[model samples]
Target: MSDTYAARAWLAAADPDPAHAELWLTYTGVALMPLGTNWSAVRVQERQGLRVASLNGPAIHDGPARAVYFLVPTEADWPGGMGELLGGPSCWLGVPAPERVEPPGIYWLTPPDGSGLLVDPVALLAALCEDGADR
Candidate 1:
């Protein structure tokens, strides 16, 4: 199987550290899940300074595809804040956005509980690196 989108990387010196990036991705994905039920994983690589990408489409349900790609400048820099977003209370009650898009799927930074959004860029890049090695 092949994909419609094809992004590539050129690896060399000055690449981001893979160990730190992978740990951050794994930690954040687990931490970011609502109710500690984050059903996701993280992967990282070094091509352009801590790059991340997702290889699979999110489990979509009942609506349009909801996940969006974002350039997280702090992806390699975010602390363990993903858990805070999931475990903490909202600034307001009955916020509609998170609730609406949750089931559809999304990739969000600091997204709310059951938001049905995820961040898998690091995972994507990890897969790419693996595929590159396989090739």
Candidate 2:
């Protein structure tokens, strides 16, 4: 799939480190659920020199589609703080499910607490930022 303007800008925002952009655009959708707001009113903002894309959509209730994609800015980056902030399980980006694992290459989030709104990772993440997240 060709990259959209937003995708390009998003990647550029990542600047010297485009890894997150790559993951977001290639493997998983990235939804930036900003602080002080519900998932419904997600808004994009620049944080620490990164373009945060906030996405929204109906949650997908299925075994393989109940995950969100997030880019770890650094190898040390994880969802511990974000999860604690959200007062729920920390949503750390986990390894991509094996091809043998049904969906194949679908990014997985960690903790697997199994009790949150079932959201479409692709829509939730891709729906943000001018539809660049979609393919």
Candidate 3:
């Protein structure tokens, strides 16, 4: 199967009902690292400067919570002090359909490109720390 198809299928499998909806509860293989909106916005802008699409990975802008959730590999050892890392069997992320980019609700800050790429945890931590110090 193509990467896009496989990725969509995997995401869809997370939903128990799997119906067409604005959001679905999905269990991702990657850990969800939620950072404050300000910090995440800065990181996103910085990553965009590199002009490498995959470097930013898949991220969600949770409008209600005012946070950005960055998807990182499950094995990545991110420091808890940096942000809350939600993963494993108990955590379920509210994922928007691949097409949901606009927002009156939760939306993608950086949507998945179907390459299965994820943000670099090391780079993320470095950026957060550097930016955190300023704020």
In order, the Cα lDDT scores of the candidates are 0.27, 0.29, 0.54
lDDT of 1: 0.27
Could you give candidate 1's per-residue lDDT for residues 1-135 as a string of tens digits? 111111101100012343443343344321122211223222122232122223233321212322233222122333332211222232211111222334323323223322233445555455445666665
User: Highest lDDT: which candidate?
Assistant: 3
Distance from true location, Cα of 3 in model 2, Å:
7.6
Candidates ranked by lDDT: 3, 2, 1
Better of 2 and 3 by TM-score: 3
Candidate 3 weakest lDDT stretch, 10 residues: 34-43
Per-prediction TM-score:
0.20, 0.22, 0.65
Q: What's each prediction's clash count?
A: 9, 4, 0
What are the runs in model 1 whose C-alpha is more than 4 Å off? 1-114
Backbone clash pairs for candidate 3 read none
Model 3, residue 84: displacement in angstroms?
0.9
Q: Which ten residues in a row have the lowest lDDT in candidate 2?
A: 40-49
lDDT of 3 at 5: 56
lDDT by residue (1-135, candidate 3, tens digit) is 665455565455444444432133233223222222112222233333223323467776666665666767767776666666666555566666555666877666677666656677787777676666766
Model 3 ranges off by over 4 Å: 1-7, 13-55
